[model samples]
Target: MLNNYPLLAKVESPSDLRKLPRQQLKPLADELRAYVLDCVSKTGGHLGSNLGTVELTVALHYVFNTPEDRLVWDVGHQTYPHKVLTGRRDRMLSLRQRGGISGFPRRDESEYDTFGTGHSSTSISAAHGMAMAAKLKGESRKAVAIIGDGAMTAGMAFEALNNAGIPHGGLMGDLLVILNDNDMSISPPVGALNKYLARLMSGNFYTAAREGAKSVLKNTPLYEFARRFEEHTKGMVGPGTIFEEFGFNYVGPVDGHDLESLIPLLENLRSRPGPQFLHVVTKKGQGYKLAEADPVKYHAASGKFDPAVGFVKAATPPKPTFTQVFGEWLCDMAEQDAKLVGITPAMREGSGMVEFHQRFPTRYYDVGIAEQHSVTFAAGLACEGLKPVVAIYSTFLQRAYDQMIHDVALQNLPVLFALDRAGLVGADGATHAGNYDIAFTRCIPNMAVLTPADEAECRTALTTGYQHTGPATVRYPRGAGVGAEMTKPLTAWPWGKGEMRRHSARPQTHGRGTPRIAVLAFGPLLYPALKAAEALDASVANMRFVKPLDLELVVELARTHDALVTVEDSCIMGGAGSAVTEALSAQGLTLPVLQLGLPDEYVEHGDPVKLMSLCGLDAAGIEKSIRERFLSAPLLRSVANE
Candidate 1:
């Protein structure tokens, strides 16, 4: 599929790549860079991060013998180039599509992908484990973890580093950590370490010694003296004594884009012993001119686009996304309540808090990539009587579930969790899907989980969650809602309630007698269930609350209808549908319940609508499933009565 990459075409795997001359590696990197842009542009995916890691990825695969020696990538969105070079060049066109190559590093997909990572900052721990395994086996294999500065912001990175860098570490040696410091994440990275790294660029002695050492002293023990001198001088005089104190040799402040610099340094680090940290600097969106100029816009590159023309706005006014609707509500809510404060785990952009940040700069807190810290941090704010609204994706929020339970829920803190990306997140696939949120959050005590059906309801739910005395969460899907006209003057909707949308119990059917089925729809699946209910002549209720779950209405519906069908855009296991069954059982209520949701297996990446249809969550699929599963019981009853 990548047609014109002559140098890249030769590299079938890391073995063929190792055979190439050192001088040709740069050219190969160039070819790989071009190919990545071409591939991702055609099929929309992570563009800028992959562009940044071109030479670094090439240099790592080139220097190290992969499959035997592990190369772990942290927050594996930057692995497109790595995927291309490592035996998946032909299948590059199928990246992120259903039944094709995964966007992240999947261990099942390739032997070269030593560890799977979609979330951030687990690379060090995984790579270090491999190193320890090699040591235990008495093998000479090496392990390298390529982690970005953004990933380093997570508490786990330091936890791994703290253990890996200690003298008594189980396996401290032969482990190399290549810090890919691009100075940019999805949102520009924040924290003290970012400031520390920004200042770490000032030391000039390491670069000078690296460039001038071997050439200047080609004669004697002085050459060894110079190399030792570089370390001693840097530790004593330079700013990187922190790594030295941690018991690992620190290298670089080197150019990550320059293959000449990266290749030799990597080769040297590979031969050495003990944990080595190499900090290489590179620009995000390095090769592509358009992406380089505006990396954030080209982050995912959105849908298919002509790379030459770049991103273009559609002529017609686009529908506001669920994120945008949340943003509007957030801004309005902040204006109304003085105690309102916004917090995100390095997701200010993705969580629809850009305008909220601008308007309430003093109240906005970007807590780096630390999701655990974000949840606990919100609890701290809530203790002071401030209403802290945590803007987070449902999947990412899983990282801080313990904190959600212990810090907020147990204590009954009034922290509003505005959970964005609450359903199948489409192209990002199962790792990022909000399918588990309903299941995960509903089980926690003192938590109100609200899922909005439309944009207008999304706004009302936020207001309601804000007004609630304890921890409340609003779960919504990823993109635009079914165009509901937003109302002004923020108003709180009734808490723990559901409304009947359609009531057609025992209505006249075309042929045989119809089934008495009550379609209790949860979250955004209300529309689809409505359509399914129409043909079946069943009653439909829009159950807005997953928790405190409209118990009265649910009991009444179960008593009235012969069968109850619960529909949600989440996992069937421990989800809202499960809650319905549990609620029915608790109240001495017995009903034939059909639970329809995401299956036990992980859903693959593709078009959202198509994936939903495939998962049997769409209108047609829901209708077919309801008819087959529940309608049969009523049909049998009618035959017996007849």
Candidate 2:
């Protein structure tokens, strides 16, 4: 159940928020923080980011004229508060559900969501484009890009700042970049501006004089003196000088948690001209004590749990997840070889490299939020005769497509890419779904694209890929395995090979001879294909390798069966199913093929189990689809006569 916040419950939209008195805004932010923790504990979404952005979200909405003035949220993980203030408060209960609102911002969902974003560091670019568009059209509207410190490390964010440095009208104006600096580890400001801004923001006299101070500084020679003073004071302490060189008027290291301070600063910056960079300092999980201590663990939440007690690590362990399986295998592999290196793009926790990093800190490399660098960096390590295993998500790997192809595949480097979350990622939806990796990786030269059926096979796939003398990928689905036990010892599977999961003795005909049918499945889809095969009395071939399709098995099976049906968790177009067809076509074999996978359209957010059945990849849906198409009267008539 969604918790009702007295102040927050009253405000239906940003217009309602603007109506509240300045004093009530503090109480409203407090209520909003509690409400997010309450709703997310029940429904479960991005918690740490939303908790961190509560005050900032309130301050921005209260100051700016949104809908008219566009605000782009980078990555959209911290948008729970933004969603609440923009007429989606009631929809918070159904957050990331099938027919409800998305976890990330969607253009179709609302006009407030200026640009749909799930990937990081595109906010500045999108907002800058909007500012230029507004300037060209002669509209008096501002565009602000709210980005996190992690997101700013991305090359795209820096590129956008560079682009905005030289604005459309040949002067720095309109575009505002609000860097939400939650990470306290990044060299903080030791100067008076931190205290100066904080003290000035607290009082009404300074807030009143802030607008006039801007005019005097812009017109008079005192402007350069004030700039020099700020530069000399916070040059080394803060990252202001770096942004200043990028042609932005940098202001802050301000108190983001204090509504009294953040609100007044936002009001002043609202009217200020030129490329303004406001660096707000806030803590992840500010209000909640337990979450504040360990923000990463509380980054996302699920089911009911009191904010007081917090998330107690589940004692009675459930099934081993695919991620956990990889983590265990990585440590084992690393222990066996000193030349082994593990790399992640700011996903030390998500990519299951925690233990690997802890055990071998020297070998573990967190390249921050730069995926492109992570891939090319691995190529460099492999060039120096070291085995580098890149632990990256299937969705994030999209950002480093060039490095994967040019640096790794082109040179035929011995780099293993462990692409976690390889199928439909449920609540994360289309933006995060890893449906294209199979198609994308298979097409590249010197790339071994392998998919594992269960937890046991996942470990083997990783081993098989790591030992291979070329660029190899082992893509696995998110969440726990299908009650499959993982092997203690590590071993590599045979290269470019697949095994028969289920084989029916003969084709079932209603008192007549009928042609046999076979289902060729890749990865997790093999379970459902096996289930569907039982009903049809068909054989199930688990084709693990996508690029090197087991031609020997496929040719023999095609000759035995009249119709061939291929199934995968990825998209039907150019997916593993297409690989089977291409192999058959090369040998001039005219086998009737049916391909089943995620359709042409993007799959929406929901429970992964439910989404599977909806996509016709589950047992019942797979059986119904197969029997309806392949088991047709006309197609099987010639075989039935035999």
Candidate 3:
């Protein structure tokens, strides 16, 4: 379908896009959007954000000398169009798949992706760094950061603005900060700033002021002075007024979709000196009627569907995602326990807390992309005897590590952390992967971590974490579980315990003629481990607890098996495998351990199986690694000989 557009299909690079006539740009954008929708529908990635940025992306690449003039995309969810235009058109189908282009901008992936970004609100800071570096090196390269209006709510964006506003060493490098106002960040963006900006941009005061200033300036003898005065007057009128205070030359409330307006404005800004701010208004799903009407539903989609009817909802037995499970648990617990409160950092919809917010508005707090504040806020609520359940992604929680340790763990605050996406999150790639949460959280004192093997266990774990008195985390993987019947009634499992799901018949090599070689799996990845174990003729243990080590099970398994393999969907370093090794070492038991998990390097975005295999966490990979570690090379043989 995209090949039909000669202007688009012929353009392999941004340089090619720059040569196209202004009149043809809209058709090119249309083709780009169509191509994105088609590709994402098949691969399933961030759809709505990319669809929205199609024009903006084309305009940016066309205007800027990319690979030299750095364009840092905040959050990078909107970088799909950027990727497609930047010589990655042919490989678009392989996006977010293992060994393919990442869903988010990756510096390693392409030179055009000057800076890698996954989390929100980092673009300004990154652009500031690039701008500063260019100034220091005496280079004339421009640094432009395109951030969404939703991302602007983040504290880091403002912090970067404050820094960029300050003149550095008497040399002011050009930093163009384009605020792509889509008016939605995952959910309808929250906070006073978002509301204030929305109102200020929409108001007719700017229009009236500009018209009045033009008439007065044209008639007056002091034209330059009047123009300066007019600009100064504009500072008090609208949203750009606030940015002007931050020491930037404010431009626009321009139509982002209009190439005629956007191109000239960008050209003017490109020639200007110092920090320039452009507030471009854009729709979340521009062009596509269905997506435009309901952006949130199509925020990220699976792949090509009937644009007329929109995305085809996957027909499945109505089952809850881990996020839904946590959301339901929070509301259910809150209904019974008045002290139970819910907290999220600008992820109300993603974390599945929208219904909870509606039901318990007073008790639910959306902290607006402030992870650090969310953790500390939970700590404060905990101090006051209110049980605060922080529903955060494993990747996002990394932002508040100090707060988690100092505010919650050190003080032993009863903050139940419902960690969603606690494993290799497919498509979103390395940046969004929840691989390090287990390693980091488990090391903290007075911290408890639980991993659910299935959907039923996920519900139980959330309740279990909620009932606990100190800092606790119930980490669950992304997506649905292995069709296990979900049980009602929040039954609490014993903390730091493991359940043997299946046992081996033959005495494994690890045990003296005993069926002992066992696979200890954590989180939802346990299903694959169990399946692999069945083929390997080894025991499978659902090690529900990550922290506290499940010592009893560990000791028993150590005594029974000569070799033990720990498998998890997390980083091997300082993770489940490391925990098991620590436990066994403390007991003075020396067992050959084979750790099967995500590697030290970042795993690229792709299919879950492909990612797992790449990281040696898949069924075949796990079996092969274990067999190689235990059977192929016996360390005990060499030790005995020595």
Candidate 4:
């Protein structure tokens, strides 16, 4: 595969790429694009965004001294082309695999990856900081932020733009903010207006002349007319007037794929001073025909696929995902109650609100990439006596914690939080993992947290949370459960109560009076704990609620069993396990308690099954841990003697 692209094979790094003739860059970009498609077909990663950034990635590395001049990418999914050029070409095959390179950029992975990113709308602030740091250190290097049009929807990007445009205490960094406008709304087809104006704005002659004219015509009516005329001229052609007000020299909505246009424009902008904005037009899935037609379907390939034929649906449909269960529940609930409304923070597809949106268009709200706003907006709706359900990923909900506390929970409003992906997420790594929600949400007063075990239970949990009078959360894992039947009616489960799935059959006392063990599992880990209970003869309780936490069940199990073990999929510290331990402390019961969950460290990207096994949360691992902790050698012999 490497040999197929001879030009790309020769480029081990950007240093080697700089040695190539300027005429060879176009051929190299073509080869690079082909290689990305091939590699992604085999490995399965971000497809559309990476395909869109090929030429831009090539031109940036060619024009700027990258490692020294920092290039920070927002939402690093589109950095596949950047990875290939920055000496990570061979590692493309190992993308998102265990013990391999990450799908997103990592600070520890490469020096060229100046900042790590996965969540959107952070590049502007980070790049401006780098530029200011370079200026403070007296370093002559540029700092560039390559942000997408979708990322620009967040308010944080504008906050950084508002600050970066002005000089900080008479000191400004050499910064460039490249808005990769792929939406195609503001930008029409590129023509003479785009190319000529982009080149003109980047030139030193125009910069000097504009400054000279202002200096000579100051305190005169002509100067005011000239300023308005310039702003209006740029405004009529493109969205440049807004950035000009932010104190940056605004350039054209140029064609990003045109290396000839991008290279010279970048070369000129690199030499310019203060802050500058370059609007480059690109398209998601630019080179691939199928992906270009439907970018959403091809956003990220799930598994290996034939590049020629593209992705094919399995003949036998797969089991419904957790998101699908939630979507169906939302529609069913909405049909029953007219006041029920569904909301998501730009994750309508990922959160499984498409069907709900189609059926109840008036009740479904897709707030654009604004998590904080979504929470407060839901609060406002709840205040009007309308039940608002926020279906969001657990990681993204972290961005709206304060809003959840002050706006919803503090006011004692009736808002339900349907948190999906509430555990270790594979491939996306620690940045996207929903490991801390349980720990964080349980601490707040008036917040009830529910951990459902299976698909059927997840639906019931949604109903339970929705029917509650105060703020409540129903968190479930990312993928499907253990094929549990979903035939039950949409109704709430008994409030804060847990059911015993399996009980130890052996006698309570043996020859040496060995104490019996009981396992309290919260969430999907209940399934694995059940398997482990078979081997250890331990009683398993599917602890449904993490907050109210079935205290009666805890005391009953504690009094009956000799040792207690708490299990969850969240962090071990300050998680459901900590809740159980705290309840025991409040009851003044002293017993052998073992806490099992995610370790106090960041788990990397890999297969979810393997990651769970590594964390000692699998069936075999759970059995081994229980035996080692409670059923020691002498106690095991005593039990076997019976």
Please name the candidate that would achieve the greatest lDDT relative to the true structure.
Answer: 4
lDDT of 2 at 151: 95
The best-first sequence of candidates by lDDT reads 4, 2, 1, 3
lDDT of 2 by residue, 383-437 (tens): 9999999999999999999999999999999999999999999998999999999
Give the TM-scores of the predictions, in the order they appear.
0.91, 0.93, 0.89, 0.97
Give me the runs in candidate 4 sitting further than 4 Å from their true place. Answer: 509-512, 633-642
Task: Give the candidate number with the greatest TM-score.
Answer: 4
The segments of candidate 3 whose C-alpha lies over 4 angstroms from its true place after superposition are 184-232, 235-237, 505-515, 633-642
| Candidate 1 deviant stretches above 4 angstroms | 1-3, 167-173, 184-232, 235-239, 505-513, 633-642
lDDT winner between candidates 3 and 4: 4
Clashing residue pairs found in predicted model 4:
none
Model 4 Cα lDDT, one tens digit per residue, 1-642? 787999999999888988999999999999999999999998898999999999999999999997888999999999999999998999999999999899999999999999999998999999999999988989999999999988888888999999999998899989999999886867788887788888988999999999999999998989999999989988877889888998889998999999988998999999998999999999889889999999999999988999899999999988888999999999999999999999999899999999999999999998878899999999999999999999999999999999999999999999999999999998889889999999999998999999999999999999998999999999999888888998658888899999999999865653256668889999999999999999888999999999888999998987777778999999999999999989988987767788999999999999999999999999999998988887774443223223
List lDDT for all candidates, in order: 0.85, 0.86, 0.82, 0.91
Sort every candidate by TM-score, greatest first.
4, 2, 1, 3
Q: Write the per-residue lDDT of candidate 1 for residues 242-263, one digit (tens) a residue.
A: 6656666676566678776667
Model 2 residue runs over 4 Å out of place are 1-4, 169-173, 187-230, 507-513, 636-642
Residues 2-46, model 3: lDDT tens digits: 556677788989889888887889989988998887787667788
Count of backbone collisions within predicted model 2: 0
